[model samples]
Target: MKVLTANRLSDGIAVWYADGGWAETVTRADIAHDKAAEDRLEAIGAAAAANNEVVDVN
Candidate 1:
């Protein structure tokens, strides 16, 4: 399993991808249970980074 995480570029606060956006905590983080889900998370992370919303996504 995997969960997408990153730091908000604006305030450098840790965040996790939940539902369709970033959340301050991990309790509701979106879980990737397979390769396809992982890929989706990666793409979302990349887009978030490209949009200057987050950094160090993993």
Candidate 2:
């Protein structure tokens, strides 16, 4: 299983995480404000969290 994470760095940088750890670091300038990206990431995170909880419960 893989999950995506976005973090803001001290220098005002936004990075995206992929299968491995952090795939690459990008400046805020590189990415535009996209609500769809936020929605998608949230959805994926929720699904992954639910899956993990299920395994723990069983």
Candidate 3:
């Protein structure tokens, strides 16, 4: 499995993709079973990164 991860813009808190959004813990991260889904997740995450809402999303 794979998950998207980053830091929150407000406080640089560690966060991960969860239930269609970002969350503060990996335990809440959404599961991605394949490369395609992971890519889609990354795309969404990249938006946050671009907005400076997060950093180092992967």
Give me the candidate number with maximum TM-score: 1
Q: Write the per-residue lDDT of candidate 2 for residues 1-58, one digit (tens) a residue.
A: 2235443333333345444233344322122247775565556555544654211110
Model 1 / residue 41 / CA error / Å = 0.1
TM-score pick, better of 1 and 2? 1
Candidate ranking under TM-score, highest first, comes to 1, 3, 2
Error of 2 at 4 (Å): 4.8
Candidate 3's C-alpha runs over 4 A off are none
Residue 14 of model 2, lDDT score: 36
Cα lDDT tens digits, model 3, 1-58, are: 8989998888988899898788987898888899999888978898989988888788
Every model's TM-score:
0.98, 0.39, 0.87
How many residue pairs clash in each candidate at the backbone level?
0, 0, 0
Candidate 3 overall lDDT versus native: 0.87
Worst 10 residues of 1 by lDDT: 19-28
